[model samples]
Target chain A: MIWQLDIMFLVLVVISAIASVNVKDLLSSAILLGAYSFLMCLLWIEMGAVDVAFTEAAVGAGISTAFFIGFIFQTTRRTKD
Target chain B: MKERYPDVTIETVCRLLIPPIQLFGLYVIAHGHYSPGGGFQGGCILGASFIMMFIAYDIGEVKRRMREKLNTILCATGVLIYAGIGILCLVLGANYLDYGILHQILPAYPAKARALGTFGIEIGVGITVMSVMISIFLNIGTAGEHEGEPE
Candidate 1:
């Protein structure tokens, strides 16, 4: 069961990353990055690095995503690439 | 006052939804040790909660909710609290973060002393993380708005 969860989490991370890169809208891409961080946090929990996981969840999901959105606001949301 | 942006369904949903989630994030920080989380995790969660608010609501609304001064205070306080623990340990004649000495001073069990110490530092981390997040969000959202204008 644990292994299954791990695999699923990994797949989710990959999907989120791919979506983040492929998404045309910067805001949506930022959201995907946040999702990626959240999944990574779960993966850390499964790996038993609770402390690292906690930090990741907070900084990665919270700070980074917020920063990304803020960046989006100061500029245009649509990206050419 | 001027309207900076248009009202939308998504922003409306965010206005209704985000405050409660932020409260939960605080709970996560407070109860981190006992659960599967700690200060940094909870702090980030708290930060994210506000960030969500910033994103969903317009910048003006976010600014109204989070003032620049308070964010500065939060950042400094977190560091002070973290340093306070190390100072306490040093005052007790041990290296930084040497909780055993704290245990010697307190009448309670040594494990309890260590736990308490950890909690203190964790609180510091949480505060730092949350404030830094807010600051970052504000900076990013507001960047280049008045870049070359005289302050």
Candidate 2:
């Protein structure tokens, strides 16, 4: 059961990781990055690294998303690549 | 076109939301030893509260509550508290970062004293992390241009 859950989240992380990089809209990519962090935090929690998971949740998912949105505000939302 | 500021509903909701988030951050810091939270986690929550304010209203709104100078001082003060505790242990003729020596003054068992020492350093780390997160986000959000004179 635990291994399956791990595999599921692993797949999701990979999907979001690719999405964040390939998405044409910078804003969408930023949101995807946040999603990626959230999934990573979940994986950490499942592995019993509660403290590290907590830090990842707050810093990666929360602050980083805010930072990315703020950057988007300063620049264009759409990207050429 | 996007509006310059959040709607009234968002403004009211954020105002209501920030306090609870901040309170939870404090709880996380206070319970770090017993729970999954610690300095860095709690600090990030506190920083997110300020960031929420910035997102809802503007940079001016956050600055109105937390002044830049005060923020800078807090960043330094956290580091001072951490180092000061370590130095105090040294002054008492123990190794650095040794919490056991704190029992000499705190009137607690060596084990409890270490726990208290951990709490102190966690608070210091929490403060430093909180201020740094806020500072970095503010600087980046404004592109090195922030309102309000140094005060």
> Tens-digit lDDT track for model 2 on A6-69?
9999999999999999998888999999999999999998888989999999999999999988
In order, the Cα lDDT scores of the candidates are 0.79, 0.91
Model 1 CA lDDT for position B38: 75
Tens-place lDDT per residue, model 2, B1-151, is 1346559999999989999999999999999999999888999999999999888888777788888998999999999999999999999999988999999999899999999999999999999999998999899898887766534
Candidate 2 DockQ category? high
**Where does the lowest 10-residue lDDT sum fall in candidate 2 chain A?**
A71-80
Which TM-score value belongs to model 2?
0.94
> Each candidate: RMSD to true structure?
4.4, 2.4
| TM-score of decoy 1 | 0.76
What DockQ class does candidate 1 belong to? medium
Q: What is the DockQ of each candidate?
A: 0.66, 0.84
- The residue-level lDDT of candidate 2 at B149 comes to 56
Alpha-carbon runs more than 4 Å astray in model 1 = A1-12, A15-19, A22-25, A45-51, A77-81, B1-16, B59-64, B104-107, B144-151
Which prediction has the highest DockQ against the true structure?
A: 2
**Span of ten consecutive residues with least summed lDDT in model 2 chain B:** B1-10
